[model samples]
Target: MTQTFDPPPPDVVLDPEREASLRTIGVISYALHAVVAIGALLPGVQASIVLLIVAVIVDLVKRDEAVGTWQATHFSWRLRSVLWCGILYVVTIPLWFLFVIPGWIAWCLISIWFLYRIVRGWLAMNDRRPMPR
Candidate 1:
């Protein structure tokens, strides 16, 4: 027996409400990532994981609705940024002592990278531009 496959329908072209809601969520996720990056500096708050969890949940839950829209790019960008930063943190955990000041330097660089992605993506979304892959 032979099986046949059909292409998926093209995405819906216009969705003002979806676009607005997506921009709102993108901004929220951007702020959430910032909070996590900064919260690490505070004395008692271990917010990186907590805030990441929150952002991931929000993004994943709404992702289905944005899949075919321009907003989907923002979701992908946000997830990649978070995933990379998390991996960097994991690397810092074990070699933290060996690297010492260099580790501190690396963490600082990673934090800056995280902030850059958030701000850049947020700005692009505000301008109604699609994120670069």
Candidate 2:
């Protein structure tokens, strides 16, 4: 017998409250990323590290509830995507310490990628079909 796979329906509707929460999280994450990028350009490694720590804290708070909701709703793939993006960003930081300019560029690219994934997943979660890639 042959088996077929079907995409699960969205677990949560995009109400005004959820939309507001998503926008808030997006803004916070973007701001934290911007600060980290700018801090990397400064003289000391301490600034970059401090900014990175702040970013991580912000990330944890922002995603904690969302992760729980996703798990409870069986949207585990979305959670995995978010987690992978975080991991990629973390791995790129030390590289920035080695070769400043190139590392910063790479970091920026990775940051953009993270934002893309977050927005994409958010849309997917809400069952909003994103535009073509």
Candidate 3:
């Protein structure tokens, strides 16, 4: 879906509460991203899909609050990122046993792509820059 975000006006002034909420969202986003990244590397906490669902819930809930702001862009990007990871994983399911080598390669590539997405978005947020459309 082509999502639309209305960023607050350039001259818009945020109240303390709104600022705090934005910060909270950023931290939560990072935590969610970190969980998936770490989970992939560590077998014990391999609940990426579940964790992503929680994160998506947070994103959906706060998305409206970020209307017209960079945070909206983040929510949009992250939701898609998680889904892409899920897609990649699902696509490799059949190949996992029949084509073990290719499946492993695909998994590794997906992991790298996932990490890139998370890190790229995190860095952009740190710089207070808007996510790409």
Candidate 4:
């Protein structure tokens, strides 16, 4: 007669302190992004580039630390959002020199999209859920 063996259980242990720290970092990053996004959407209200830079720096630095955790997706989502927004803005720069109205319109749409991404990500983070890939 042959005997059947059961597979081992997966590791489910987590460090509570580390998780709390990661969540706090996520909140700070989201807050900074929200401020920048709102400022961009508003008329004549310039958001400080310094804040964006700091948020980016925070995401880049702490991202690796959050690997294998749910928070990693948030870091990735924020970074991708910033990268895409910058690319879109640069691609539309010629519109500014060509047609003022169209350029303004393009930037407004992009700003709205950026704000949406920030809000969605922030909400997912608050709910402690991973962002949809």
Tell me the alpha-carbon RMSD of every candidate: 7.1, 7.4, 3.5, 8.1
- The best-first sequence of candidates by lDDT reads 4, 3, 1, 2
**What Cα-based lDDT does every candidate model obtain?**
0.78, 0.51, 0.78, 0.87
Q: Which residue runs of candidate 4 sit more than 4 Å off their true CA positions? A: 1-12
Task: In angstroms, give how far residue 71 of model 2 lies from its true place.
Answer: 13
> Which is the leading candidate under TM-score?
4
lDDT of 2: 0.51
Error of 2 at 69 (Å): 8.4
lDDT tens per residue, model 4, 1-133: 5533222134534489988999999999999998999999899898998999999999999998877677788998999999999999999999999999999999999989999999999998898787755
Q: Write the per-residue lDDT of candidate 3 for residues 1-133, one digit (tens) a residue.
A: 6745456688767778996788688768768877777677554667556776788898888888877776778888888888888898998988788998898788878877887888888887887776776
Q: Highest lDDT: which candidate?
A: 4
User: lDDT, candidate 4, residue 60?
Assistant: 99
Q: Which portions of model 1 show Cα errors greater than 4 Å?
A: 1-11, 41-48
Pairwise lDDT winner, candidates 3 and 4? 4
| Per-residue error (Å), model 3, residue 45 | 5.2
lDDT for model 3: 0.78
TM of each candidate vs. truth: 0.81, 0.42, 0.82, 0.89
lDDT of 2 by residue, 20-109 (tens): 675565455545554554444445632455654565565555654544243222133333444675687688788778888877787667
lDDT of 2 at 87: 87
Q: Taking the tens digit of each residue's C-alpha lDDT, what string does model 1 give over 12-34? A: 66468767887788888888987
Model 3 misplaced regions, further than 4 Å? 1-7, 10-12, 43-48
